[model samples]
Target chain A: MIRARRYQDARAQARSNPELAWWVFMRVSGVVLIFLVLGHIYMTFLLTSELQASYSVVVNQLAQPVWKIYDWLMLTLAMLHGVNGARYSIDDYVQKVSRRVWTKTLVYGLAALIYVLGTMGLFIISKAMLAG
Target chain B: MYRAREGQWAFALHRISGLLILLYLLIHVVSISLVLFGANAFTVLHDIYGFWLFRVGLIAVTGGVLYHGFNGLRVAIMDFTGWGTAVQRQLWYGVLAISLIGLLITAWVVVPRILAGH
Candidate 1:
């Protein structure tokens, strides 16, 4: 029996270069973020009659795994994707190739640090809730 | 060198908006999660929706989500395909309309719920 082999090259290309996918995704995601961010801000800053949302409120909501994961996904995607975008900007305007590279390196490092700290903070808080 | 103006803008905004949105999402989740963790920590969000300022904020958040999320989708497509440039111009308008509609719908749902004070 003769077997047909899949076009592994194209698939690999697509996987390696997700540019096309991300392009289409930007429109959809951007539109969605507009709503998500606006809703989020309003709820946090404007809606609460109380000037501050108590810590208890925060912990209670974080307990839901869905929300936790939602946050994690959002955080990771935005940080990585956004910084990646910034790297492009640096490349476009910044004349020096080395500068662009260095800037991106720093930007990426900062993003990583923030992600680490933020995740750790959440984990500690989460564990505290469970321990009690 | 390829002019990455649009692409770069998309990239920068993706990060800015992504970061902004992430903070909000985190807080949002945690706000609600606190209730699950401790009985004493249970904070009812019922009051939040009712506040006028929060209502407006919700509308803006809805706007941000639509803009940032949808725009992110647009850039994502552009990276891997050549068709990205062609669609960007038209899609911006399309995105705007969709966002408006979404905001309206959200308002419709949220207003009654909040105003009724349920």
Candidate 2:
């Protein structure tokens, strides 16, 4: 984790090109996710009631291509962003190289699984499937 | 343990909130994914969610997301801008204020509904 207050510091402190790239990705993805996620909360939790998230409502929303793409974007972006952030935490607190590696492997594996599950759920829903 | 001031508090809160939100997201994805199993499987959520504990937990999740998102914006601003570092303390306050407002708004809107059992 590059703990720099400015972009120049981050660039200079980066051990490798990919580390610097991830430093940049965190900011970029963080900005985009702020809007996407806040809007999602606003629509789902603020504007609409939780009761509206009933099975039929969720199925109908997923059936639409627009919501499917929007949710997929959120799932992918948020998962990557959150996983990377957690990796930084793991690096900071976890001592012992062996423990760190195992922790990271588990974290990455779980993130991948959740990402695939979320993506599949978003795409696999349709009225016919629900009926059948 | 090191004694922390505003910046440390900000960093600590950001990390805790970020990890908690990620945990919630994993569970959320799995629960929502149950739709693939058919209505019978999905409807199980109605009973679980109707539980008061889960309903209240959603409010906490909302607050956590708000703080993480706003503090994240503060970090981005500090990263890319020259003046952002100078005013980071103020920016941290702004993040907290905004998050509080969001939490209040969410609770206001959702609390009654939860009470009414909707």
Candidate 3:
């Protein structure tokens, strides 16, 4: 966790290249995700209630390449961003080295599994739509 | 416990909401991915989520997203600008105000739908 008050300070504190990269990645990804995620929530939940989004409606949307790409972008970016943020927290609070490694392994494993699952889901829906 | 002034509270809330959102994201990916099983599988899960309990939980999720996003921007501002650190307290209040307004607007749109049981 780069606990610097300024970008220069963050750069100064960064112990390695990857550390600096992640510090920059958080800010960049965060700004992008703010728009992507909030727009997703607005469109999917607020603009239209989830109750109205039945299975067929979901299929219809996902069948489109556009919505597929949109969702996949959100899924990929949000997962990476969220996972990295979680890693920071884990580094902070999880003190014991062995326990921290185990915890991080579990989190990263789960995140990778879900990312693949979500990508498969997005593509599979289009195929299902075509076959039906 | 140390005295948690504005910055401490902001940091703590950011961590909590970030973790909560990550937990939700894990479940969300899995649940949505059930669509691959077929419409029946998808609809079954969807209906379960349509329960009022889950719907209300989503409203809280919206609130969490707003706060986390806005506070994130505030953090970025503080990191990039010198003056941002000087007025971090004010920026934190602004973050709260924006989050509250967004939550209220979301509730206004969603509460009625939840009430009608649609």
Which number leads on DockQ?
Answer: 3
Clashing pairs in 2: none
- Proportion of native contacts in model 1? 0.20
Q: Runs in model 3 with CA error above 4 Å?
A: A127-131
- The per-prediction tally of clashing pairs is 90, 0, 0
> A24-67 in candidate 2: lDDT tens per residue?
99889888988998899889888988777888888988999999
Cα lDDT of candidate 3 equals 0.90
The lDDT per prediction is 0.56, 0.89, 0.90
**Residues A1-132 of candidate 3: C-alpha lDDT, one tens digit per residue:** 888989999999999889889998888889988999999899999989988777778887888999999999889888988999999999999999999999999999999999999999898786455366
Give one digit per residue, the lDDT tens place, for model 1 in B1-118: 7676554565465556555655555455445444444545444563454577776676666666776767655644444457765787566666667767877876776666556554
Q: Tell me which of candidates 2 and 3 scores higher on DockQ.
A: 3
Across residues B1-118, which tens digit of lDDT does each residue of candidate 2 receive?
9787899999999999999999999999988899988888888976688787888899899999889989999999898898998999999999999999989988999899988987
| Model 3 CAPRI quality | high
Query: A17-132 in candidate 1: lDDT tens per residue?
Result: 56534443444455454455455555654465333445555665555687566566656655555655555456667788788778778767766766765565455555356446
Score candidate 1 by DockQ.
Answer: 0.18
DockQ-superior candidate, 1 or 2: 2
How far in Å is the alpha carbon of B78 misplaced in model 2? 1.0
Clashes of 3: 0
